[model samples]
Target chain A: MAICAKIDTYEQMYLIRAFEERIAELFSRGELFGTTHPCIGQEATAVGVVTTLEPTDVVTSTHRGHGHFLAWTGDVQGLMAEIMGRATGVCAGRGGSQHLYAENFYTNGITGGMGAVGTGMALAEKQRASGNIVCSFIGDGALAQGILHEAMNMASLWDAPILYALENNLYAMSTHVRDTLAGGIVPRAGALAIESATVESDDVFDVIAAAEQAVEYVRENSRPYLLELRTYRFCGHSINDERAYRTREEEDEWQRRDPLARLAGALAETERRAIEGRCRARIERAIAAARNAPVQDLGDIGKGLWKS
Target chain B: MEKLTVGRAIAAGLRKKLADDPTVYLLGEDICDPYGGAFRITRGLSSEFPGRLINAPISEAGVVGVATGMALRGLRPVVEMMFGDFIALAADQLINHAAKFSWMYNGAVSVPLVVRAPMGGRRGYGPTHSQSLERMLLSTPGLRIVAPTPRHDAAALIGAAIDDSNPVVFIEGKLLYAAEQATVSEHYDIAHTHPPYPAAVLNNAAGEQPNVTVVTYGPMLPVVEEAMTAAFNEDEVACEILAPSEIGPLDTALIGESVARTGRLIVAEEGPRSWGWAAEVVARVVERWGDRLVARPVRVAGRDLPLPTARPLEDHVLPGVETVRGAVEKVMLQ
Candidate 1:
């Protein structure tokens, strides 16, 4: 068992938590305009899975991808600037929030578009002999899309090096997973004869262990595998969504299972305090950087429409 | 110099491109293995380059999506849709994802992807497979549309498309693939003469002052040429035939220059009339020289109905040689 580290992993979780909380505040204050699917309670899954990846490896994220993007790639400044639709944003304001994408991270704003695209990215990686694996992160709701199955089947058949990470956060917008998906999600991958495992989202170390194993399996065999992180969202689907669909008790229960606090508790008392302090300083600096960033002019909308 | 058919020239160009760039690869149905494409354009390719020439399943959307993904990852991918009409299945990936990726990412990502589809309706492939959907793609903003009319243009334009750093839709005419004569050179030495991808003037039949200008491309080129020749012999009317080899950047300047000189213009297309490539051409011409036109700038196109199954009805529905001739006569009279 690989012992969980406090400095790197805990700092990432704190940064994601701080980032999502700041985004929610900015959005509620009307400073940030556009749809943002905050990864508030889902920080552990992104941190655990992304920590297992290197800078060279590629990943395709879903709409609720702030945690994944910030965890694997750049910091909160570029992400917050992106959400504010500024020229300094990672995508230069064209991709606002739902469309936040970066080439280095191999990220796209697509909802379920990553499932198939990740398969292609993995094929490209395999062809280049880059020894890099592609991780495709999708919501449990995306399992029902036909494109996902098509990509999984092809990836398995060709033995492409890919990890299909299903962040089963219990709800797809308003409907529960049990309502939208038939049978269980992990068993679906087994039907395709893919090696799959399910891990609790609250257990950050366990999720990381599963991700590490899956990544190694893909790299060794050049075959696809599935890892389902059983988690729950503490907030509604989007900023505009109300909690009418679920109970406050359900939300409170997930909040108590917050992966950040759980991971922080596992650390030494002095180390935990030091890590939290560093995370706070980083978040404050990022907030200042994003708030002071230059705004994008309306004329700049057509500037980045093509490559010269 | 050797005379090669358009299909042969395309195959030769692809072969040269694959040999030149290790990153370039071909993917499509029947494009590899025991059979090399239905049209045999990719014949003998799988044997020459075993692993590079990939034969994908009969999934148009999957192939296109995969190609887009590959292109995003620094590999130039050429994906073929056996028939142009079947490209509809992959429109989501092509129109929504591949086209918008670069722009959506604020030019951070370039989809160096080529989607090659054999289009046009002379073979009686029926309604499902014979429809020309180039106009639908032309309406898309981020894609470069190229249709090569001549053999040399077919060979040269593909090289340009392969070299382009943007996503391109290379629509090859099924009728011209086996009929048109091309002068192809060896060693992939075709210098890109035109501006990356632009409209080309195959023959300036009218010399300096052409009274009527005929605008057409792809499979409609032969019909336009035959109609113009017949009209010249019968009525002694000299017309200028202009073929816009590339459609997306559209080469509005070339079309505008010709329409401006001729004063009378007739745009012909094998696809439907409404919102077709002809509409874009006419709109650009009208925007530039709408006041100086001899007539309303007549548009000659196929009927607005679904392509018919019967031979006679299909022939009637499609723009024939006489139909283009009639449009030329009408535009000249006005």
Candidate 2:
């Protein structure tokens, strides 16, 4: 059985895909404020990893984190407002898309920085016996950072209840993982005593199965678990990238294996059409509400400089 | 009232806070018992708290990042960076995350985290081990930097740092740890309840007609106090000192008031003269008391060079009592 119904997972994935598509269109028209790293082809991984989490459990995300944020909060209006830098944003416009924080979700613009933070949160939960597990999502490129290794070592040492989920999308902004990363990311963490596993496909059911097992293992063993979710990004690194590195054939191959279409194929036609309709309607409402929402005043930018 | 070295005082403060609050815990390199921290500030803490005192790996960024996460989860974690200099490794976390989490999150959460590190030079620890990095910390916004003067209680300051509903960097002076008996002198006046520990008055023998106001903090407090007293009694310089026990969000008002009255000012510190905390003190004073100054304020601080390993060389490079005394006289005469 799936952690979430197959139909529900499809809806979440559809929301992610539709949200990014709208953001890209908005960016193209100079409507969206900042650049975004869309997870167009990796929807399954984002929703799959997050569905295993309880409401009280925490997660930390990376720069390309819209999908993760939506999977965690499902607050489309607040999230879109944040991406648009509106006052009704989750962070009151201080944090845009890259730095969205909600009830238990936090995403920063820095690579691999959330690793230590998530590990620490897991440590806190274990100390309190809260039974809540933390998941920190990172990309293949973040493997170059040394801080991640340090957090991994301490996580294993402390037996923190955390899932270090890696979305190895083949490229770290065009510099292929093979070119930048030395040795295997899973083995490097394993040397620090972290239990490691890897899922082979980007299929929603496969991701749910692998991620559910990983989340459960960490919860029961009370240790750090590393999961390498094999996936690919259909788009370039960002809106600015020209993609002169990879061939067109490579892009086409990845797009053909799109996680969104794969999940839709698994769902019944009526159910799939309904979920797509709901996602489109919700996205349209969220975008309209976010645009109508007022932007933060220039004077109030520094209002909360310190917590009195 | 308690007789304790600065190190012991810090340990006592941690002990008390942990006992009082179930949420408070400690993490740092060699912080557990048997090792008791590099300077013994965490001595016997692990034995008392057991699993609460966690000895961390040599990963400053990881430790601080983890502490920030813990704070996010509502745990009051006091992290000990073995050396204040090593805090540079964790600067990104302190400056970007811990310092701004609540504010960036728009007051959605409060990070009640404490980072305790020993600062200042003079223990022959050389460049990497010894540095008065408080100057760098002072430049970081949204973070409270607190240091202790001999007049203020170290443990009390630590307790205050822990109690603060924000991220605080509690800088402990290595030299202060060597004091066999801790006694807060009465002449160094002024005492505030919280971090940015209250500024003090020194060498006000003339009471109402003090000739100069010298501002300093941390380990430089004693040296500046001695110099001010010697200048007042022998040289008739009549100096009044305003030294905040805490550093950041400096209490420039106290120094400004004293400077306005004296018409002369001197800022003495252990860090380098260029871009030191003295620069900030001078800037704040000049903004308000520029018209009142009878002479240009002098900054007495370490030379802009790496601290040498030899004791004599280090003393020569760092600002000394004679240096402060001379600056006081020079400012008074002008």
Candidate 3:
């Protein structure tokens, strides 16, 4: 069963925020390998959209995908160990944070590359009558990629059951969506004649409501639907990003709409504290388990080497 | 069992897979009825398999990416690129996603995607339409490549490529579609689980010690054979031809054994001279036979220049039998 309840939605958002906070701390302490694009303030968009999906439903993620990935798979320990390059990671340490894949879940670092693949997955699903919808998440910056439009063209033309979720955090690594995007994300899909909907809130429940309608629209219409989520990231694009592009006032303004703070305001203080405590404890256990996980041996690193 | 053109053989292979397996489908630009394919390799198959063949939008990246997605979703999809040069647009999917899925996903999945692109420089289709861009993808580890020649059954090799678990980029020589011939009575089959390099050596004559070994494949196979025939009769130089159907994961060991016997090696290909498959073959030959080599191996390749649309210049660029023969004679003299 998929996560359809309001309290469960809140719990998922809390866990995502806690996971991102811990990941940030690990990055600062030089504990994690490689670079990570933290989805700090964009938890609601990830969790809300993923909540509407069943276990059999497929989702392709982006580089800043920990929130979306963890929300879908709920494998926090595996993800933590993966980013740490441990052998027991989700992808056996092969995929760091950007690249990861499970049975029905795929998260890659490529911006617009997975768009058509997700569309193709939906095509297969529809052809096989599997009734499993596919959702591929891309950043607002990926709007510039030509492959997305090409994929959306075919997905719409063929009426494939897939949802293209655009997590508009307003910044494609310091470049604001308004400054970089020509018209807007929705209009581009609209021009392609693909049915699309937009949600302009960071509230977890609000996103869930919008996602449910969009997911249903795709399933019934048997066509690709674009869901544009209006959210903001509290932190920089990557760990090293100082975010000099946006001013302190703007950052503070967006932080006011933080999903975590909003969820807390929506719930009673004691209830909020209890959920937050459980989320924090869950993240702590995940981190401890990940730190203790065995790492891939350096000597046997080329386990899948085919050609000499 | 019927004799068929290289193009028809490829179409036959696609037809067999589409008819035999419900999971097999096609994605390409202008691949539907009336258009078939730019090279007409997929000619006359869409009507037989209605709705299975898709005339894709002019999106190389989209076509390849979608096929890769289908492959990952447990369906085999054959993607056709109208021209091999256009594959440059699909490099992201071919090099990164399709090729890296199996290994980067830590052996959890294998992409059974076959991308068939018509490659070569004989046609005067200018710089964009003509050029063997397979050189760019030869370094990608997890991808398999098959270039069918006149000697091998094109349908069987293509079928083998389709059955492969990993991604396979099938390179059909654009010029060889009409110029070369393949016997249909011959059936080529290989296991999808483990497909090694399909390397074959054709002797110029039986019971003769070859003075030189000519390593080439695909479109150059028939051309190299013609050159060896000339070199054998006129120059009195016996030559051996080693053609490997699989481009990446090439069986250099086969080439090494042949070269160790012949002592001289020459690699001929339609791609440009620099950083092409021929150069890689030469490097491997030298690596396998360091000081035992009698002469520095020669590589017969297209001149290091962008292919032009002019017929004379195009012919001047792509390696011909005369050029290969000249190289073979030069290597023998050394």
Candidate 4:
């Protein structure tokens, strides 16, 4: 990747981190209602994979999809307004945080059961032969769902151009990946004769490299590929969760490997300072934009509630 | 015009639609080859359409999800659930994804998909197979629900559903398949449009000045009509029957007007009484023109308990002509 692209990726990841942290703050203040699954620690995974794809390519996201949305094609102000249930929000306040739908990214609220739905979208794209691949972002927990298996089997059998980007944040709410998945997920995909790779999701470049290869394989052969991103969530599962399952040492260890800090450190001092200033300015502007936006009314509730 | 049963009518309609539009495809379990369908509704369709009529695995969600995907890609996919009760397994794809996609996507996408499920209780298929789940689907937004009581209505409704740019849950009554008859046309007539709402008045039986108006749909239409005739002859009351072809976008205007004119209403449904289609009709009528009603609206629905397998118990559990007529008489007395 070029130096400018690398800097842009870093800035994007930082913006996502800042946005999520602000959401966490608002959630704690009881300003934002509803359960929010923050993609705090998994910022690199979202930014990296999305940065690799063109704007025309589509993606299907999980409940913790703010990072993915921001990474691909979402405006920060519209996203914040949506979380606040404002009329000017992306979904006109009907979708709230979980059901946010922007240009190309489709966010599924609490139902992590859309693994097959994403595959279906990919199949449609493939049939259109639009030269646009679909990247389905799923959590490690959703692998247990029967639909994921069905989607994988169908995508593989039909040679659908789909990239299954599994964000293995180690824990699904409170349960660890090892405790939930048998023999882990990568080997499971390998058993199906599908090409699979595991990347250090805390490193943005590592994830980007893996995503690039996966995207290439899917687009070239019209076959599905699985890329397991091994990362961790720095915060609790939701606003109410205290994360009593994991140890303080584990959390601290993962925090030390924060992607934003790693990328900031990789740049020159002047470049790092300039990038940090730009990201802070962007976040401040987004916050100002959201605060000034009008809240959505009950009348607009039914606007985007159904398709015409 | 040759008379044809609702089942044969549906098959004929599918054959016609498939021939007319190459994009149209049929998918379901046992819908291809030697075993056509559980009810033989798709009999001879496999050989006629070749690879277009797909015999999928026993995965209801997979079937619906695949159809939804195909519909998103511009293919007019007609998916069968085998039985209405089986739709529960595919509820995630049907309710969350398909029903909400167009709206969630800000009208950027439309789920032009039709899900055909066999509904109603008449074959003594027990609790699992015998269910009119049109009410369940009607509760879901962005989904157009259609129930055809007669053969012509079935053909018209199926063609309408196929042409519709929205997701449609087309419920076919198992009893209507064998009982009702109508003419089935081969040519695709885009002009043959079924009203999205308001019940179809199959027969006024007693012309104008109808003393009683019986509202029913799906398989129970024949039962209500028969019971209305028997009860009226046994007594001296005149009755008119109205059956709605479309369940969703319910023609409230037609129903309210009919109730206002007849001054009496007796809604008979094969589904559960609580929050069923019958309840919707009563609510709509009362909300719109309750003051004009001669008597309180009455509903005759299936028993709250699960449908029984025993022939005697099954017949007793389902709403028959007697039950409907009794309700009609009771409402008329009030």
Q: Which numbered prediction scores highest in lDDT against the true structure?
A: 2
TM-score per model over all chains: 0.94, 0.96, 0.95, 0.92
lDDT of 3 by residue, A1-308 (tens): 23336557778888888888888899999898789999998999999899898889999988998998889888888888898888888887888999987769897878898998899999999998988899999889888999999999999898889999999999989898888888777898899899888898878888888899999989888889999999999889998899999999998998887887876666667777888898888778878887888888877666554322
Per-prediction CA RMSD (Å): 3.4, 2.0, 3.1, 3.5
Which candidate would rank higher by DockQ, 2 or 4?
2
Q: Cα miss at B7, model 2 (Å)?
A: 2.3
Indicate the residue-level lDDT of B10 in model 3: 81
Task: Flag regions of model 3 displaced more than 4 Å.
Answer: A1-4, A298-300, A304-308, B1-3, B180-197
lDDT of each: 0.81, 0.85, 0.84, 0.79
Greater-lDDT candidate between 3 and 4 = 3
What tens-digit string does per-residue lDDT give for candidate 3 at B254-294? Answer: 78887888889999998899998999999988986856679
Candidate 4 lDDT by residue in tens digits, B1-334? 5557888878887888999987788888899878999999998989988878877767788778777867866688899989989998888888888888777655667788999999988788998999887887788888888887763456656887888888888889998888656432121111222354335564333354767667777888778767776776777666656677777757677677777778898889998888888998899888888988989989999888888888899888888877987897798798
The regions of model 4 sitting more than 4 angstroms off are: A190-193, A297-300, A304-308, B1-3, B20-23, B183-198
The ten-residue window of minimal lDDT in model 1 chain B covers: B184-193
Give the higher-TM-score candidate: 1 or 4: 1
Question: Candidate 1: where is the Cα deviation over 4 Å?
Answer: A1-4, A267-277, A296-304, B1-3, B183-193, B202-208
lDDT assessment of candidate 4: 0.79
Q: Provide DockQ values for all models, in the order shown.
A: 0.61, 0.76, 0.60, 0.45
Q: Which 10-residue window in model 4 chain B sums to the lowest lDDT?
A: B184-193
lDDT of 2: 0.85
Please give the lDDT score for candidate 1. 0.81
iRMS of every model, one decimal? 1.7, 1.2, 2.6, 2.6
Error of 4 at A3 (Å): 2.8
